[model samples]
Target: METKTKKTLLPVQGKILWDVIILSILSVLCFLLPFAHYTYHRVQWTVSGLQFITGTSVQDGEVVIASQWLLIAFIAAAVLSIVFALVFPKIKKIRLAGFLIILGGILELLFSVLFTMQVQYIMADARNAGTSYAAWLLALIAVITIARGFHILYKNKVLSPLDFMIMPGCIYFLINNYFPLVGIFIAFKRVDYSVGIMNSEWVGFSNFTYLFSSSDAWVMTRNTILYNVAFIILGNLLGIIVGIFLSEVFSKKLQKLYQTTILLPQLISIIIVAYIVFAFLSNEAGLINKGILGEGNEINFYNTKIYWPFILTFVNLWKGLGYNSIIYLSAIVSIDKSLYEAAYVDGANRWQQITRITVPLLKPSIITLVTMSIGRIFYSDFGLFYQVPMDSGALYSVTQTIDTYVYRSLLQLNNIAMASAASAYQSVVGFVVVLVANGIVRKIDNENAMF
Candidate 1:
């Protein structure tokens, strides 16, 4: 029985060993394949990975040296992977072998990305210099090697079933959330499509100066921050009121109907909502203009700037109220009914019970939502500011926010670097605001603060 078990295990171990050796060899071979394709002064050419490592001269007399450190690191990782695979199993360090393989795969993958970026930077002036399929194939092999390493770890009991279950989500989060963070570098670059984004010249704070130097900066900043402030205060206040009202309703059917009716607007597309606002506020053939004010007495709501602040505030509140109320209502439902009953027995009226019992207990939820809102105070609802106003130039004074300004700049100038700078500014400021707000909350009530 022991001999049969040993024989069966030998094939499995041999298969894993062979897989690592083959992948390491293939990674080394990939360096001999075409790594980049380029066109210089209307002449096309391809450069192999080995040429990139050894350094090459382009048509324009530019000496292109893709990072020597990265090339050396990649070669070292591949060589070490083969050596470890052979030696570790002999020493019975199988788990250490798996870790080394994982490290090697990560180094190869990092080398692929960094090397391509470096190549693009060096060949920036080329008409269309780009990474070839060999680089991507190397990256794919690196990914496979990583998966195999993880499998070995699992077999050795280094990883749990739950780790495998969460692996997909972790990978998705890295690709979707963390990977795009690299674009933050664009804010500091003067982007040139011919040279690609990574190769663009650095301009320090020049991109940011476009926002601060302009007179419109203060107006847009005011509009964005004030509107968000109103939205946070009034949205939460009304949501709590409606949530409490809904909780008190005796009829379940009527409550559901009310809930559905209110949430309908939240579900409506922003474009449709904009049109709905236009239908009511339009100067010609509008419900308000024709039915109430008459034809000649029409108020040019879109052209007039004074009414917009209130109009926008109302529209935003109306549209978002249902969704906000549902959140508070869910929190309200989870409250102990015994508290409200006890308050009633203590001779507290309905209003007093709400103020003394319901609202106080809802503190944690309110604090959480408010902290989250503060984190986005620098951002604005672009549609609410732009589309609802019908893009009337007359209302630019009141309607302009950071988002709309960046959008208009993008449309008119097509300055992606400037747009990226504006976004980075908002993100950084919003992050600071959230930290400040949470710190204040923590000072006031440590338990309720969102850490």
Candidate 2:
């Protein structure tokens, strides 16, 4: 049989009508469900739909999904659920059909269930007690009605409710995240607590001068930037190599074991990870001293500045490689096996298949990882440098990055100004690096540039 050509789905305005309806229902359900819904005698998932939506037991906060929550997740689910309903009817539970449709319907229902669960999770996010469900619902309804009113007045469907996705996201990002970025200039200000934020006098590069004036500035900054560069390079390379090797391995069980093993460090917490590292490197009680070498002498890891760069890079990779590999693995899996068959027909060996087919296809993911990484090169992993070293001054030469330096200062001086200034410095450096890197990527491969 000939290969099936795929058709791409395009977004349309009319597609969002279903979303409006579903969202309206979700909003109303959220508003009334808690009062109408019930829970088991003991707190459990068997609670009423409203309870599932409102249940509080800090997912991020004692936060009920809706109970004491005030129903923010309910409104969110209602709104987004409507959008999914309108645009992707094929995936909608009420509209599913066909032989594979049974599985598809189960998956869609699972998706919806999981999606609502996630809304509850985000509502409990460390961000707040929960967002205001009433305010959000009112805003959503107002926005939808206004859009429809505008559509009727213009007598042209120039857009639809789905338009809010891109528009609202852009606007909120600009207002909340990007707008605050302008404060980077404050890094150069002589910010005194008494002077207030904006009232603080502008020092015009004085803050930067003060930073550079420190003797440890160059060393710390250099170490931070260099370590990040090394992480971005080595982390992605190792991740891709491991991902590709796993993809090529014949035994599915072994591949899964390796994947899980590489991924474990990423899943574990940094604090726990520091303790784990200490178990091996501790001077007296460490495995290296007692178990491995059969010696009881302490290694005095605190003073070992020379070993830290390598140690930091290794830890960074160990923590990140599995997570990053998923991207490469996805790219590899997406490649048409026909390409591999063609390579094999040309007498290409397994090595040749990888070099010729796998690496080339994975370039997009690699570039993306590198570019995103370059954007954060000035920022160091706070956990790795600070907690891992136990904050020993002896290792400061290698471990004291801009982040840890700022933290150390924060603790010693209680100086928020300096901390903000250091953060601003990292942002400026990181932003400039991202812009330059994007420009270079654009020159080399226009499609890959983030812009």
Candidate 3:
């Protein structure tokens, strides 16, 4: 029976093997076709993928070097696919061949886009120049090859329909989230726009000096960590209180109304919040000045350093409370009601039932949120710190967290490397803080800790 099954599979495998081999060869041959066209000061130049990969010379003795690594990768993928098709010629090998084809196609597409962008950047003054027809044809061929590869894998049961369903989200994250992580290199490099990012000169830790060597370093660091500490403590405490209150409310309509009312501040734009704050605190026309304090007692709230810490803390909590409460409420809702019922039967008052049952059960949710918050302790709300303070130089001593400081530095110095370094530093510190916090939690309660 096994022999008969193998005999019957041979014809199907043979057909797929030929198809893979043919597509692989065609993808390689695409390199010989015209890849891009450029016109520099009335001179027309058309270069093939082979020429681009080898480096092409244009007007003014300028050499446009397309990334050779991409060419090498494409060739490698094509070679591996063809070898697999011819040598193994089994269902598993055929599926592997298909994956290789898809990979080669993606590489080819990236190469085409990057090559075109490089040429355009180099010859900025060039007119009537862009990717040639062959380039588009190469992309089209790549798409078809990728589709054929997926078809083979699916037909062979190597990939299920569920895999296809999740494929889009996987691709989205690969492109948007994971791919940009490569930009971390920008923190270490002296970026030159004339040459692309990969070709930039290395500066080591010099970019990092902007963050630590400055006089404001202590001020920003202190403000960032302290503000985050307050936010985590106050936000979680109030959120649990609000969540518990909402959970206990018997009227469904009243619960929803209160939920929406509390949630409205979270939905309001920070910019609008700033202006609303301005309306109350404005030195000249503010309601406090015009209505309560009268003209003679008018105070400059934006420039006053003392008022901002409380103002910012209040604003942050107001905006975050509803969202935070909703999260805790979900966990509260999921708790077994029988525990609370048993506590009440044992002569426990409402407050005792809450303390003994509700809050204890909420320990896991609180720990999870607190652990996550610790990871971002080195960061702050940019709009809340910057905009609410109205960019007051007087308030810098009180309000300059790491994020606002980075934004101000970028604006004043126009230094991309320095900005990247600041970001990288915050990320590293936050990551460490999270690990330490989680370790402490894990030591205390192994089950509640988030790994």
Clashes of 2: 19
lDDT of 1 by residue, 1-451 (tens): 9899767667767877898889989998998898888987678788888887776777756455534777778878887887877775574545766787787887778777887777667767766878788888889999999988898888989889998899899889977877667679889999999867756799999988977898778898899999999999999999999999999988999999999999999999889999999999988768899899997799988888999999999999999999999999999999999998888899999999989988998999999998999999999999999989988999999999999988987787798888888878888898899999999999999998888
Candidate 2 wrong stretches, greater than 4 Å? 1-176
Which of 1 and 2 is ahead in lDDT? Answer: 1
**What's the distance in Å from true for residue 346, model 3?**
1.5
The global C-alpha lDDT for each of the candidates, from Candidate 1 onward, is 0.86, 0.65, 0.81
Top-down lDDT ranking: 1, 3, 2
Candidate 3 pairs with clashing backbones: none
Best by TM-score: 3
- Backbone clash total for model 3 is 0
Candidate 3: tens digits of C-alpha lDDT, residues 165-251:
999998899788766675798999988867767788998998887568887778988999999999999999999999999998999
RMSD of each: 5.5, 14.2, 3.8
Candidate 2: 10-residue stretch with minimal lDDT: 93-102
lDDT of 3 at 137: 71
Q: Where in model 3 is the C-alpha error above 4 Å?
A: 1-27, 40-44, 60-62, 66-112, 134-173, 193-199
Q: What's each prediction's TM-score?
A: 0.79, 0.62, 0.84
Q: Which ten residues in a row have the lowest lDDT in candidate 1?
A: 58-67
